[model samples]
Each structure stands twice: as C-alpha cells, then as structure tokens.
Target chain A: LSINQVNEMEYEDFISTFGNVVEHCSLFAAAIWSQRPFHGVKQLHKTFCDFIDTLPKLGKEGILRSHPDLAGRIAERGLLTTESTKEQLAAELNTLTPEEKANLTRLNEAYKTKFGFPFVICARDNKKAAILSGLEARLENETEKEVIQGVEEVKKIAFYRLLDILQHEEAEKLIGGW
Target chain B: LSINQVNEMEYEDFISTFGNVVEHCSLFAAAIWSQRPFHGVKQLHKTFCDFIDTLPKLGKEGILRSHPDLAGRIAERGLLTTESTKEQLAAELNTLTPEEKANLTRLNEAYKTKFGFPFVICARDNKKAAILSGLEARLENETEKEVIQGVEEVKKIAFYRLLDILQHEEAEKLIGGW
Candidate 1:
C-alpha cells in the first residue's frame, strides 16, 4: 500500500500489515499506531526504532531473546515465524552442512550462555559463513554491548521486512488486486 | 520451575519460558516482568489477565489479531507459532478432510469478514466440530460482542497455556535437572 493508503488504514489493518516489521515485537507497532500519517516509510521505521530505544536494558534484551537462533531448534522443527524462515533461508542457513550446523548450534548456545539472550543478526543480510563468524565474534562482547548490537540487528531485519512489504505493495498495485 | 524459582529467575529466562503463553504477545510477559515474585501460578495468571483487561478496544483487537486463524494459511504453511500449532493440532484442526477444510475455510473467512479479527477459541479446549459450529454461531454476533468474546477466548487460551507450563515445571521438578 502507498504511504497515503497506510495513513488512512484502519488500526487493525495497519497492525496486521506492519505489526511484525519488528520481528515478534508487534508491541512496538501497536504503541506507535496512534502516530499515524507518517510522512513515509522512513518515519514509520524511525517511530518503531525510537519506541524500541526507550525500553530499558532488560526490555531490550527481551526483544533479543524473542529471536530464534540461527539454524536452531525452531528451524530444525520447521516452525520459525514466516519472517524468520525467509530470512534464515535467505542466509542459506537451511543449506548448512552437518558440520556447519553443529558449529552454529554450539556457538548459539555459547552466545546465549554468555549474554543470557540468543545471538541475533540480520540473517537476510549475511551468508552462513558470515553468520558463523559473526556469532563467534559476538560471543565475546559484554552483555550490555551485545544487547545493543542485537537490537540493532533486529532493526536491520525490520528495515528489510518493511522494504519487502513496500515491494509487494508496489507489485500488488501493478497487478491491480489480489 | 516453581513459583519460588520463577520469582527469582532472571528476566530473560522468565520471558523465554513464559513469553508465548499469550500466543505471540510476549509483550504481555515483558510488560509484567517487573511484577515478579508472584505468590503462585494463579496470581501470575491474574496478573496477565489484569494486564490484558486494561488494554483499550484497539489494543484488545490487536491482541486478538496477533493470533493466527484456526486452520488458516499460517497453519497450512506450518508456520503458526509453536504454541498455536500445538493448540490447533490438539483441536484436531490439522486432520480435517478436504471437504471439512473447505467448509472451515469458508466459515473462517465469513467470520473474519463479519468481524475484523479472526475467530479465536481456545482450540485446545474445543474440538473441530465445536469450532466449526462456534464460528457459525458467533458470526451473527455484533462486532463489539465478538471482540469481548474473542478476548475472553484468548484469556482461556492463555490459562491453558499457563497450566501446561506449570505441569511441565512439576514434571521437570520430579525428574530433577536436565
């Protein structure tokens, strides 16, 4: 839908479309739905980020903890959220070799043990090798630093999700209707 | 974990464990993390219900909308949240024959068209027949009445989910640490 369409969208429609832009943190979208008539997508993204930025450390960590691990149990069970499954597949996380999967499993656990939250990166923006190395690198950061980094990664994921919606909206416009 | 243990558990652990009790609304759990030291499971349940009760109309609808539809596209894609998947399967929604699926799909769409949010029942507590008839019956209600009923159904879902967690905690306690 266009920005004008979004501005005029009903509350329920606005949420169902963009609520998941911030992963499972639809509360971010719900809280800011009142700030309608967003000039464009960028301001909409900023509203979500600013709401997220206001949360305390524990709240931010909760957001990180909401993310499933890369090649983790949820993926193994084929039950990742639609957004997560797409992002993971985009990173070729599903194509990892047995050894790579095992390594990722190990590092994901270690990262959680170290920071008490799952390691989160924008899987759509990183390949398996980058994801593996990034996990190893992030495992060393302090919890506070990791929370900030993880939240930043969530925002990156959100940005891509928003863009995906925009592209689909454009395609829908061309196709006339669903 | 016991309420005692839960009372002392870290915020991240608390969320990761109980966050999905309200379907995908982890924000409910996150919003109440500070109100720790709940006397027991009932108290915790009340806390959640109270938090939910406080939400305004749109907010309540958002919670209802966050839930995936019964036997809907998300279930067909096998991407329903883990909690929802189990609940739907328990209701035997996954076992519907082609004709049954078609009937349910038609009714579900009719219900959604009549009321903005999907028809939500505590699927774990109701069989497919009940669900189908329930959908047919509820379609005639006013939207405001449906919203209240839907939110009440959500609370029932959350109640069962909490009890499942409590039972698991009991079993875990009996088995000792992993």
Candidate 2:
C-alpha cells in the first residue's frame, strides 16, 4: 500500500488492516507492522514494545492459517513488500523444490490429522528447511501452546519486515542521533 | 550465576555487568537488563519501553557488532552457574564464544585475522549451523562495526540465557503460556 493510502486510513482502519497482519502471524507481521509512520530503521525499533502492548490475542485456528506452506516455489521468496498480485505469483511458482514439495505434503497430512488446520509459520526470508524444521518441532508441542507460540513468532517476523518497508530516510535521520 | 551471587552484586556491579550486556546487544538484552531485579518477566516486559528509554547511543561500530555468531555446540554447552564465575567471565571474557571442538580451528583463525579477541555470541538453544551463519555474516561487516554488533548480539544471547538459568521455572511457565 502507498504512504498516501496509509495516510488516509483512519486510526480504526489502520488498526484493523495492521491487526489482520498481526493476527495472521502475530510474531512476523506484528514485527513488520509494529514500525509504522516512515521512521528510519533506528527509531523504527523503539516502537516495537508499544506495538506489542497493543497486540490483540489470536485464536488457535487463526494462528494456524497465518503462515503459508513452504512447499512449491515459496521458500525462496522474500517477504511481500507491495500489493501487486504478480509479485505473489512470481514468488510462489518459481521457488519450489522436490524435497520441499514432499515435506509439505507430509506436514499437511500430520497437521490435518492432529489439529484439522494447516501448519503455519510467518515466512519472510525463511527457507524450506527452516520451515520444515519449525513445523516438525512444533508438532511435538501441545496444540494449544503451539498455536500461541506460532502467533508470537509470526508477530516478530512481521515487525522486522514492517521496519524494512516503512522506515524512510527522514525518519532514520531524525532518530539516528538517538 | 546462582541467585545468591546475583543477589550479592551491588547496584553498581549489577549495572556494569548489565551495561556490558547492553553494550553487546541493543535489543532485549538492553531492554531487560535496563531494569534490575524485575519482579517477574511480566514486569520486565511491561517496562520494556522505559528500558528502551535508558539506552545509550548506538555508535557506528558498536551497532554493527551487536549480533555475535552463534556456536552450535558451544551454545549447547553449559556455563558455570555460580556468581563468582559469572562475574569473572563477565569481566575477563566480556565477549568470548562458547567452546566447541569443530569451531576451534576457524574460531582461532577468525579471531587472529579480524581482531585480537575470540568470537562471541549469545548461544542459547542455537545449533552449529545457526552460529556458523552468524559468524559468516558478521565476517562480511567492517571490523569496527562487527565488534559493536557482535557485542550487542552476545548481550542479547546472554540476557536470554541468564533469564533462562536464573528463573528456570518461571521461564518455562512463560514459554508454556506463550
């Protein structure tokens, strides 16, 4: 979304869209969206705790669906920095590997059998190996706790990505001395 | 260090040691250590903003070195849990990597080539690949910046590890709740 569009968003609307980001992968999206208003990367970090404080609690199913599967060509893709549909297609279709394809299949089966939902992980700058590792390790966790932890991890990921996209030079300059 | 040793540290000693951790990493280590004798993790997290407020300037070199390379085996290896060793290690090896057999060769070479000090990272629950990745990444940074960033990274790693060791039950409880 453009800064102009973001500027037009009412506080409530801003909260809603950004909240969806957080609710999806509380750790990843929250980390990215947590830094708003075009500040440089430096001051961008200061806002994280504030964002954390305002975070809404996510439910198990909501958290489960937040992350996409790592199979296909998705693992090689980076975080989505724009609203273009083409970017999404390019990322997903070009990066899948044979191992990731097979692993994702097994993960789908296990996740469906255990929790009736697909496994989720906020996937920005994450490889298929990392995703598979996370998925396998999380399987050992109680469904309830894993859901919560997954949300936290997602938010963290979001907060970081948000900084990369939102922070501007002026913001960085203003906060640089701090 | 044991609770008893930590309990014995004067405020000055505490601050100095904590500052070293902050000097090492500017994120959670600085945030958590900025507040002392926190009643609980909740309090520590709650006052995260206040802690950030107390952060010193992030100089160029210092900021770059904030993240240390994680050592897979060294991270898994345990530290002496008493306060005496904690203080001594804190003073003497302000930035030392955890020992690992596989890393000894490279770690030695890297230290000799880059700086006069051994590589350091906060090695909690990290594996060899993760730590190696950190080392390789930091090696790309300029010497001055790498040291600063490395110290900060080490601080973050240590702070989390310290919290884990100190309030073992509480950390577990918090992890479960998350």
Tell how far residue A114 is off in model 2, in angstroms.
1.5
Per-residue lDDT of candidate 1, residues B126-174 (tens digit): 9999998998999999998998999899888887777667756554443
lDDT of each: 0.79, 0.45
* CAPRI accuracy category, model 1: incorrect
Compute the lDDT of residue A166 as modeled in candidate 1: 65
Clashes of 2: 44
Tens digits of lDDT, candidate 2, A1-178 = 5455654553324444443343332222223332346333434334543444343332234334434444422334554334212322433524556766677778756864675345655555355566677778877778667656665665555454444355365345443231
Calculate DockQ per candidate and list them. Answer: 0.14, 0.01
List candidate 2 segments past 4 Å from native.
A1-9, A12-20, A23-61, A72-94, A170-178, B1-178
On residues A1-178, what C-alpha lDDT tens digit does candidate 1 reach at each position?
Answer: 6778888875557878887897677766655666777876667778778777866565676678677878888788997889999999999988899999899999988887777678899887799999999989888888778989999998888877776776565544433111
